[model samples]
Target: MTFKYDVIVVGAGHAGCEAACAAANLGSKTLLITMDMNKIAQMSCNPAIGGIAKGQIVREIDALGGNTGIVTDKTAIQFRMLNRSKGPAMWSPRAQSDREKFIHTWREIIENTDNLYLWQDSVKELVIKNNTVTGVLTNMDVQFSAKSVVITSGTFMNGLIHIGKTQLRGGRISEPASYGITEQLSELGITVGRMKTGTPVRIDGRSVHFELMAEQLGENDFHKFSYLDFEPRKLKQQSCWATYTNEEVHRILRQGLPDSPLFNGQIKSIGPRYCPSIETKIVTFPDKTEHQLFLEPEGETTREFYLNGFSSSLPLEIQLNALQKIPAFKDIQIYRPGYAIEYDYFDPTQLLHNLETKKIKNLFFAGQVNGTTGYEEAAGQGIIAGINAHINCHGGNPFILARNEAYIGVLIDDLVTKGVDEPYRMFTSRAEYRILLRQDDADMRLTEKSYNLGLASTQRHSLLIEKKEHINHLIEFAKNYSVKPQYINSGLEQLGTSPLKQGIKLIDLILRPQLSISKIAELIPALHKEIDKIKNRKDEIIEATEIRIKYEGYIDREKMIADKISRLENIRIKGKFDYNSIKQLSTEARQKLDKIDPETIAQAARIPGISPSDINILLVLSGR
Candidate 1:
C-alpha cells in the first residue's frame, strides 16, 4: 500500500499525539502511524500527570492549543496544586487520572480531528533521499509518503526489558519492540545510545490490607489541569496508601542484586538518578533504614494499584518476597512484576532549534527519542516539532521560544545547546527566569503566539485578550486605590497579620507575603466586586495577579538580564562558519564548537568550557 501525507508522525504516545495534533491543527495533512491503535496515549508508567516543573510545561502545552491538559482534566479522578506552601513560582497543578480514560480521551480527540489520519502498523524505516526524509516504510511493506516526518517513539526502539536474570524483547508489558528503524538510522550515520527506565509492580487493590497503611487523600480544594472552563467531575476521589520498606525488603532486593542487569554489568545504559530502583536506593542510601512506598489506585474500577516507590527489575520471586515485607502488602496479589527497559535514543544536540535533524531535512524527532524523560517534557517537544515541521513544509520560519519565555523553552534550549549525557528531566532550577515563567500565566504569555501560528482558535484568542485587559484594569485599580486603616486594619488583625498604621495602595498591601488578593477583596466591597467579575478564572489568574504585585521588581530585573543574553541569541552564526580558522581559540573549545555546530553565539556560550576568550574570538570572526 502507498499513502501520502504532508506530515507523517510515528508512534501515538503523548509526544506523537501532540506532534500530530499540532501539525494537523495547523492545516497539515498529517498521518499518525502507531503499532497498536488501542494503545495510543497509554500511560506506560504512572497514571498521574504533571508535577513540579513538569506541571508548568503541561499548562504551557495547553495554552499553545495542545490536548494534554484537556485530556488530563477530562479523565482526572483527583486534582491538587503542588507546592502551595512555597512561593507563587513553585505553585504547580497536578492530576491523578484514570489510566484507561486518559488514553481513551486522547484517542477520541485525535480520531475526531480533521486532516489527521491514523494507521495501525510499526514504522520500519525512514525513506530518506539526498539527506531529506521523504516518507517512511512500515512493517507491512507499505510506503507512506510525506513532505515531513516526526518520530516520537518513546522507549520502543530496540527495547529490551529485564526482570532479574530473565529478559524479554519488548517495550511495555506486552507491547512488541519496534525493529528496523534503529538499523536504518545507524546506516544514516546517526549515533544511538541506550538508556533504561523502570516502573513499579501493580498489585490487586482488593487483596491489599489498606487499613495498615496511612491514607493519603487529595487536597480539599483542587484545581483542574486545563485553563479552559470545563465541568469538574464530582466522582468520589480515591485514596492512595503509604507504606515503607523495612530491612527485610532490602534483604530480599539484595539477593537479586548479583543477578540484576543494573549491577551485573549486563546493562550499558544509564538510569535516571532522580528515580532510582529499589535495589539502587538500598545500596546508595544504606544508612537510611527505610524508604517510602505509595500504593496508588490505577483507576476507579480496576483492582490494580501501582507500587509507586518500589520500582525494580528484580526477579519475580524476589519482587513478591519484598512486597510481602511491606506493612499493608502482606496479602497482596501481584498484577504485574516491575522491570527495566533499555532503548535507543539520539543525542538531542544533533538536532537544530526547530527539532529538525541536521543530517536530514524535513525529519524531526521528539519525546524519549530526544533523551527527555517525562510525559510532559516529551509532549512539549512534540508540539513544537509538529508545529515547526508543518511550518517548514510551507516555507515559513520555525517558531522558537526563548529560555525566558517558558519551561518548554528551557527544555528545548537545554537539549539543543547543552545536550544530555543522561535522560533530561525538567526542574525549576533548570530555568534562570522561572519566577517570570510561572504556571498561572502560561496562556497570557504563549496563547498569542499559538494564535499567530494558526493553532489557537479565534475564541481562545479573544478570551486571552479579554483576560489581559481585565488583569491590566485590576492592576491599575489596585495601584490607584488606597486602603485606609479603618477599612483594612480590622481584617488584617483578624488574620493575625500586623495591622496597618497608615493609608497605602491596595496593591502594596497585597504584595505582603501573608495577604492574598481574595483576602483583601473580602475586606473592601468595591474591590470585591471587581474581583467577582473575573472570579471564574480560578486561582491561576489570582496567583498571576498576586505575583505581579509582589515580584514586579524581580521580574523587571530578570527581564533586563534576559535582554542582555538575548543579544547574543540574535547574533546568528553562519552555517558555514569555520571554527578551525580561529587560531587563538582553545583546542577544546574549537573541537567542541566544530562538533556541535551551534547556531548562535548564545548557544555557543552555553556549551561547557567555552570560555569568555573563545566567545570574543567567535564574535570578532562573525563581525558581530
Candidate 2:
C-alpha cells in the first residue's frame, strides 16, 4: 500500500508532536507516524517539564506557536519558578505534570489539528532517491510518500534494555524496539552511535513514611508556561517528598555494581554524565555518606511515586533492599525496577543548521535522535525542523535563529557545530547571550519570526505587537514619572534597600539591584495607577520591563559580541568545498572539517581541534 503526505514525521514524542503541528499548522498535509498511538507524548522518565535553561526553550517554543508549553500548563499538577532567588535571567518556570493527563491532552490536540493524520506503525526504512528523502516504509510494508521527512525516533532504534544480568529488546519498560531503519540508514553511509539513558524506579507512595521526609511544595504564586495566557486550570495540587539514602542503601547498590551493564563490558554506549545512575553515583561519590532521593507523585490520584535520583539497573532484590534503607521508604513496594537502555542516534554534525541532513536533502532529524536529551530541547528543534521542511518544499529560504535571538538557536547551533559525544543537554552557560535571551521576553524576541513563517496566529502576532507597545509605553512612563521621598522611601527602606535620596524616576529606581517594578507599584499609588493604565497584562509587562531595565548593559554587550560572530556565520561555504586541498590546514582540522561539513566559518571556529590558521585558510578560500 502507498499513501502520500506533504510532510511525514516519524515518532510521536515531544519532538514529533511539535514537528507535526508546525507542518500541519503551516498548511502542510502532515502525517505523524508512531509505533504506539496511546503512548504519544508520554513522559517516559520524569513527569515534569522545563528546568533551568530548559524553561527558556519551552517559552521559545510557545513563542513559535508549538503546543508543548500550552500542553504543560493544561496538565501541570504543580508549578514553580526555579532559581527565583537569583536574577531574572536565571529564573526558570517548571511544572510537575500528571503523566497520563499530559499524554492524553497531547493526543487530543494532535487529533484536533486540521491537516494532521496519525499512523500506528514503526517506520522501517527511508525511501530515498537522488540523495533526497521521498518517503518512509512502514513495518507492514506500506509506503508513505512525502516531499520531506523529519525523524525523531527518540531511543527506539535498535534499543536494548538492561536489568542486572537480564537484557531485553525494548525502548522503555514494555515498549518493543524499532528495527530496520538503522540498518537502512547505515547502508546510506550515515554514521550511527549508541547512547544509554536510564530511568528511576516507581514505588508505592502510601508505603513511604511522609513524616520522615521533607515536603517540597510548589510556589505560592505560580507562573504558567505559555505566553498565550489561557485561563489557569483549577485542580488539587500534589506535593513531592524528599528523603536521603543512607550508607546502607549505598552498600546494597555497591553489591550489584559488578553486574551493572554500565560498569561491566556489556554496555559500550556513553550515558549522560550529569544524570548518572545510582551505582555510578555511589561509586563516584564514595565520600558522601548520603544522597537525596525525591519521592514525586506520578499524578494527583495515583499511588505510584517516581523515585528521583535513584536510577539504576541493579537486580530487583538489590533495588528493593536499597529502597527499604532510605529514610521514608522502609516499607516501599516496587512498582517497576529502574533499568538502563541503549539506543542508536546519528551524530548531529551530519545535519545542517536548518536541521536537514547534509547527506540527504529534505530529510531532517530532531530530538533524541539528534543526541539531545530533554523534552523542551527536543520540542524546540522539532519546531525548527518542521518549519525548515515546510520552507524547503515551498522553495523558500531556510529559517535560522541567531544565538542572541533565542535559546533554541543556541541549542541547534551547538548540536550541528559541536557534535556531542554523549546525550546533549542545554544549560544557561551554553549561551553567551543568555541575558538577552531571557524567558520573560521570548515572545518579544521570536513571535514576529513565527508570524513571518505563518506558524503564529494573527491574534498572537497582534498580541505580541500590543505587548511590545505596552512595554515601550510603560518604559517611557517609568523613565519620566518620578516618585517623592514620602510616597516610596518608607517602603523602600523596609525592603533593606536605600531610601530615595531625592525625587527619582521609577525606571531609575527599578534599575537598582534590590528594587522591582512590582514593589514600586505596591509602594506609590500614582505609580501603580500609571502602571495599570499602561499595562493591561501585569505578568507580561512586569517581566518584559524588568528584564529590559535590569540586564540592559549585559544584554547590549552580548548583542555586540553576537554581531561580530554572526559576520563569520554569514560566510557560507559550498556543499562541495574541498577541505583536503588546503595545505595550510592541520591534518586534524581537515579531518574534523570533513566530518562536520560546517556550512559557515563560525561553525568551523567552534570545532574542538580547529585553529585560527585553519579558519583563516577557509576564510581565504571562501573569499571572506
Candidate 3:
C-alpha cells in the first residue's frame, strides 16, 4: 500500500521523537516509523538526561517547544544541579529518570500528537528523484511518500555489536540492525564513516553492598529543565551510591585486554574520547591507582542499577572478576555484560546549518547519525531538523542558532565547520560565549524566537513574560533599595564580608562574592516584602535577579564581543564566490571554501583551514 505525508521521520529515538513532534505540532502530516513501537525515546545508554553542557542543551530544547525536558521532568527519579559551587554559567541541571516511564511518556505523546501517525517498521531505503528525497521504502514492502524526510537512525545504521571474541549483528542487544539506507546514501556521493560507543553493565540492586559505599543524594530545590511555571518531577526520588575501582580491578581488566574487542582488531571505529570504556581508562591512566564509579538507579521502582564509569567490552568472566574487587560489588549480580557497538554516520559537513543535506534537497540528518554522542545534543539537532523540514515542505525562513546564542548553536557549527575526528560530546569549554548561554536564561534566549515561528505555545510565552516582569521588578528594587550600615553591618560581618562604612544599594551588596539576595533579604523587612510579592517561581526569579546583578559586567562584555563578530555574520557569501579562482587565498583555504561552501563571512572564518589573511582577502574581494 502507498501512503502520503508532509514529513516522514525514520527511527523513533530521542532525535526522532523531537523531530516528529516538532513537525507534527507545526501543522504537518508527519509519520514516525520505528522498528519497535514500545521503545520510543529509549534510554539506550545511561538513564539520565542532562549533564555538564548537556543540561543547557535540554533547557534550550525546552525553550524552543521541544518535549524532551518536559518528559524528563515528569519521569525524573532524582534531580541535581551540577557545578553548584561554580559560577551560574557553569551550573547545569541533571536528572536521573525512570527509564521505563520515560519511554511510555514519549510513546503516549507520539500517539496523541495531532497530524502525527505511528508505524511499526524499519526504513530500508530512500525514494529519491533528481537529488531530492520523495519518501521512504520500509522493509515490509510498504512505500510512504513525503515532501521531506528526516533520518535520525541513531546506532542502528548497519550496527555491529562486539563483546570479547563474540560479534553480533544488532543495533542494541537483541534488536536487529538496519540496512540499505547507508548504501543508497553512499551511492549518492555522501561521505559516511563509522563510530563506536558503549554502555556499562546493569547490576541487580539486591546484590550490592549499600553499607560499604558512600551515598550521593539528589538536591531538593525548585530547579528543573523547563521554564514553564509548573511543579516538576512526579516520580519518587532515589539515591545513588559512590564507589571506586582499585588496583586489583585494574589488574583483572588488564588480564582481559587480549580478548577485549576495543583493544583487539575486532573493533576498528573511533569511540568517544570523553566517555571511554573501562579498559580504555585503565590503559590511558596507568599511573593512577583508582577510578571513581557511581551506582545509579535505573528507575524509581526497578531494583536494576546502572554502573556508571565502568563501560567495557571485555569477556563476561573478566568483567565479573573485576567487579568482585570493589567492596560495594563483592556480591554483584549483573543482568548482562557491557558491550561496544559501531555504527555508520554521515559527515555533518555535507549538511547545511539548518541540518538539510547539501546533496539531497529536503533531506535532514540528526542525532548519532550526525556523529554527536549525547541525548541532549541529539534532541537539540532534532528540533532544528524538524523545524526546517516543516519549512522545507511549507514556506518559512530556516531556523538556525548562532554560537554565542546557545550551546546547540555551538554544537552544530562545530560539526559542520570542523567535522568530528572522534565521537562528539558537549562540554562547557566548547562554547566560547557560555556566560551568555546559562541554563538559567535559555527561555530568554530562545523561547521568543520559537514563539514567533508558531511552535512555542501561548501558555509558554505568557509564562516567559511573567517571569521577565518578576525579574525586572526584583532587579529594579535591588538597584533602588538602600541598606543602612547599622542594619546590615552585623550580618555582613557575620557572613565574612567587610562591614559597610555608609548606606549602599542592595544591588552593591549582592555584587559581593560572599553575599546573596536571599541572605540579604533576611535582614531587611522591606526587601523581604517585595520578594514575597512574587508568589510563583519566587526562587527562580530571585536567582535570575542575583545572577544578573553579580555578572552584569561579564555579560555586557561578552555581548559586546558577540555583537562585533555578528557583523561578519551579516555578510552574505554563500553563492558569491568561486573560491578556487581566488589566487590571493591560501590553497587549503580555497579547497575548504569550495568544499564546505560557508554561508557567511563569520562562518568562513570559523573553518579550520581558513587563515586570518584568507579572510582579509575574501573581505577585500567582496568589496569590504
Identify the candidate with maximal lDDT.
3
Clashes of each: 0, 0, 0
How far residue 124's Cα lies from its native spot in candidate 2, in Å, is 1.5
Measured on C-alpha atoms, candidate 3 has an lDDT of 0.94
Candidate 2 clash pair list: none
The residue-by-residue lDDT of candidate 2 on 1-624, one tens digit each, is: 689998999999999999999999999999999989999998989999999999999999999999999998888888889998887888889888999999999999999999999999998889999999999998888999999999998989999999988999997779999998889888898889999999999888778799999999986453778878657555568898888888998888898888888788788899999888989998999999998888888887898889889988888888998888876888888788999999999989889889999898999999999888988899999999999888887778899998889899999999988899989999999988777888888988999989988999998898888888878877888889877887777898898898877897878888987777887788878767867775446666777888887787888888889888889988977475778777789999988888888777887898899999888888888877
Error of 3 at 137 (Å): 0.7
The TM-score obtained by model 3 is 0.98
lDDT of each: 0.88, 0.88, 0.94
- Candidate 1 to truth, TM: 0.98
| Per-model TM against the reference | 0.98, 0.97, 0.98
Candidate 1 CA-lDDT value: 0.88
Per-residue lDDT for 1-624 in model 3, tens only?
A: 789999999999999999999999999999999999988999999999999999999999999999999999999999999999999999999999999999999999888999999999999999999999999999999999999999999999999988889899999999999999999999999999999999999999999999999999998789988877369567789999999999999999999999999887889999999998999999999998999999999999999999999998999999999999998899989999899999999999999999999999999999999999989999999999999999999998899999998999999999998889899999999998989999999999999999999899998898889889999998898889898998878888888999999998888888999888888888888989999898778898889989998999999999999999999999989999998999999999999999999999999999998999999998988899
For TM-score, the strongest prediction is 3
Where model 3 places Cα greater than 4 Å from the true spot, the runs are none
In model 3, what are the clashing residue pairs, if there are any? none
Per-residue lDDT for 5 in model 3?
100
